[model samples]
Target: MITSPDNDNNRDEPMVFIVIAKAYETEGGQPIDLHVMLTAPDDDTAVRLTLNALSEEGFLEADLDQIGMITGAPDEEPHASAYQGALEGEVAIIRFA
Candidate 1:
């Protein structure tokens, strides 16, 4: 499990977050759907980590729509894979082309 560098939540387990966002790769360009899944100690940390990850992934700007916590791993494709990746300390992103 991965937590933000500044996270102070002392929980032993990481909380899974699913963030829905619209991102732009270029100025004035069309928006892209960027859904992310990751583990963090808290909601604030999760948002921060997601923003940083988006920047690192080359997104110029992003507008987050929602952030939800997952009580259990998903049983579907894509989401299931993303959830597993989050457990292994990765910021898993799902994109639709």
Candidate 2:
């Protein structure tokens, strides 16, 4: 769970991001769609781990999105290293060494 180092210091750490998925059914009436939101760690490592766990459990469509480099404010606030890797050949592969 790639959490901020201050997770113990502060009780307001954001550990997970929400992902919304849905399924729809249509009959002679109005179409009804069922929506589900899943919460998982926002970092790459936890995302990969969760995906792998789901894959092992037979879930195939769940995947991760890459949001390249981010620009942060030039203040004294502490920051952490980001997940390293490129989205090679359309696959969001994260590498940690």
Candidate 3:
């Protein structure tokens, strides 16, 4: 669901990673859930990219809870949009505030 940074993969493919995170827009503000979707070769890269995206989105702090790979296209609203964005080399975040 996401594009690889180098545009290459060992098997000519990258994995879609969904990072579940609790993020704060401002210091001491209420946390919101961010489902960050991206593509990377490995989990490490996924986590790093997800964090970086969150930071760029103005999240001051983030608590990463889980990282999972999505093998199929999501059939819902935010997930569907996020997945589509990820495939286009964008870190798509579904925010639940």
lDDT of 1 by residue, 1-97 (tens): 6565756645566789999999999999999997899998888999999999999999999999999998888899899999999999999999977
Candidate 3 differs from the real structure by a C-alpha RMSD in angstroms, to one decimal, of 6.8
What value of lDDT does candidate 1 attain over all alpha carbons? 0.92
Q: Rank the candidates by TM-score, best first.
A: 1, 3, 2
Clashes of each: 0, 0, 0
Segments of candidate 3 deviating more than 4 angstroms: 1-12
Highest TM-score: give the candidate number.
1
The list of candidate 2 runs beyond 4 A from truth reads 1-14, 21-42, 63-97
lDDT of 3 by residue, 11-75 (tens): 54457899999999999999998899998878999999988989998999999999999988899
Query: What's the TM-score of every candidate structure?
Result: 0.85, 0.27, 0.85
Number of the top lDDT candidate: 1
Give the runs in model 1 whose Cα sits over 4 Å from its true position. Answer: 1-12
Error of 1 at 13 (Å): 3.9
Worst 10 residues of 1 by lDDT: 2-11
Candidate ranking (lDDT, best to worst): 1, 3, 2
lDDT of 2 by residue, 1-97 (tens): 9665745434343333222222122233332221111223344654555455445544445434332222332233211111111111111222221
Cα deviation of 82 in candidate 1 (Å)?
Answer: 0.5
